[model samples]
Target: MRPSGNAVPAARRPLAALDEPVRVEYRTVHGYRRAFLRAGSGPVLLLVHGIGDSADTWRDLIPVLARDHTVIAPDLLGHGRSDKPRADYSVAAYANAMRDLLGILDVDRVTLVGHSLGGGVAMQFAYQYPERVERLVLVSTGGVGRDVNPVLRLVSLPYMDQLMHLLRLPTTKVVGRVGAAAVRRLPLDLGYDVDDLLRIFEALPDAQSRSAVTRTLRAVVDWRGQVVTMLDRCYLARAVPTLLVWGRHDTIVPVDHAFVAHAAMPGSRLEVFEGSGHFPHHCEPARFLGVLQEFLAATQPAGHDTDAWRRLLRYGRGDGATDAGAHLADQALAQSHRTAT
Candidate 1:
């Protein structure tokens, strides 16, 4: 007859609570504008968005998690709101940017949650700074393996990377808007059922609106060289309380990578969202939020916690891509904190 705490993020809490546009004027080591979004207050949870995505991608799921987490999602340098330096744009650079941001915020520890490229950064960060990460969550991540789709192979080409730079070089105004619209449209037409991409777009600042598209594409293109050190290190992926959320129909990254990551990190839990594509958090909001909350809940410490629905935090947020979307709604929580300043 009683309820749990995490329920607020699921039912009542507005996404804006977690989507509050943070405009910190933080800079990279070399001094480039880096913006990030921070919300909620509990255990520190750092969220990393995937390729072509900013913190806005986590809009649907953050409120739910932020209800119980001090959610901090950064637009990796050259992606969302971070600086787009012309220097090295490898995954290692991106990971270092994260480390710098954490240091700025004085975040010494966290349950790192990364999606796509962000996921790669998270894994690599965990490998580099094992003590800082209390837990790890990889969602449709890259850098975990070498098996990539033919389309991705083309996207990651050196020539294509140059082309991206050339395009953004002339003018990022009309070019940026056109590219942004295309990215949103094509993905929606392919798999996502959402009609209002504007809602997500609105969450971005005007400053971001100008440079986001071209910069994001370039960042995606530039972060092509893969790193296997984290993947090779079993202790990194499997060392902490790990949670992986992936979509079964994710052609962009494919669904099998989840299993591959699980295989690499034995006992690591997987959530393959059915009928969902790359942005499971958006396509299947209810289910995605449910599973994510459950996963995080399982890792939540007890005693002082008083959320009523906390008990109902069951259900692994994952389903086999081929399997029906039946195996949802069980308590599955996963493990964060640190001072960067």
Candidate 2:
């Protein structure tokens, strides 16, 4: 499973395999079966997917990561093979689910990596239980700034769930394929993001999946733009080793947020893929793997210190909430500004 220099990610893979089998396993959480793929045996690496995606989204990077780390990719509630209950889909909920899932699996510590929506969840997970996280990797993550794609904002609208239902009609696939083909013929350079979105749309053949999708979207987004943000709390990561990865061409979530976030977290590392889009790991597997491996090797895993965390929370690093806390508060105010127009 060595990464090739010029390998383009396949649209789909039959299965992700390491030197050993990457088998899909399930854990019953809140009476729902949460499906996950686990392989290798070393430092635990938890991979979380974004909205409209599943654990399978990590297929391109899992095998390579598995070479030296235990990779755990889970299908979040309402996505993939996991049961989509009429449950809360907020970042905090997802973080708690991951915590409980790790508890069941007896995994105490991990290098947490998350993409898009998963990134927000990863941040929340680290904040809630800092002791459980060894390191942090955020790739094209949301909740940094309120600059999400317009379509995602539309999906957050109150009545869009009904519209999404209509899109699941039997003839929708035929119409989508025709539209996708037409788009391909145009001179415009729309990458695979449209195709990926269409595929995600087609996946919602049932009401449960559709409900989950809409609920999840509405939890993080609103008609105004992104309503949930982690910038306010990113100061908490000062003691943790953090890496920021983004695609310069990403339209889904602007790459500029990565720079702002990197600055916000004093010691974080930022890597930008020059010509890549939202899924940089998929588009540039070799480079992504190399960067991740190098970061993991260079940094030491973080350990929780109760006294320091308490002091930081109580007095906020000597400046009396005038430094990191001030900047974070400003970001929170900016996040509240309406950007949908």
User: Which candidate has the highest TM-score of all?
Assistant: 2
Q: State TM-scores per candidate.
A: 0.66, 0.88
Per-residue error at 202 for model 2, in Å?
2.2
CA lDDT, every model vs. true structure: 0.57, 0.80
Model 1's C-alpha root-mean-square deviation from the true structure amounts to 11.7
Off by over 4 Å in 2: 1-18, 182-189, 317-333, 337-341
Q: Which pairs of residues collide in candidate 2?
A: none
The sequence of per-residue lDDT tens digits that candidate 2 reaches over residues 28-54 is: 988889999898889999999999788
- Candidate 2: worst-modelled 10 consecutive residues by lDDT: 1-10
Candidate 2 steric clashes: 0
Global CA lDDT computed for model 1: 0.57
TM-score of 2: 0.88
RMSD to the native, candidate 2?
4.8
Rate residue 305 of model 1 by lDDT: 23
Candidate 1 lDDT, tens digit per residue, 226-325?
A: 3232433433234377888887867566676676566556557888887566666666677766776777777742222223223212422222222221
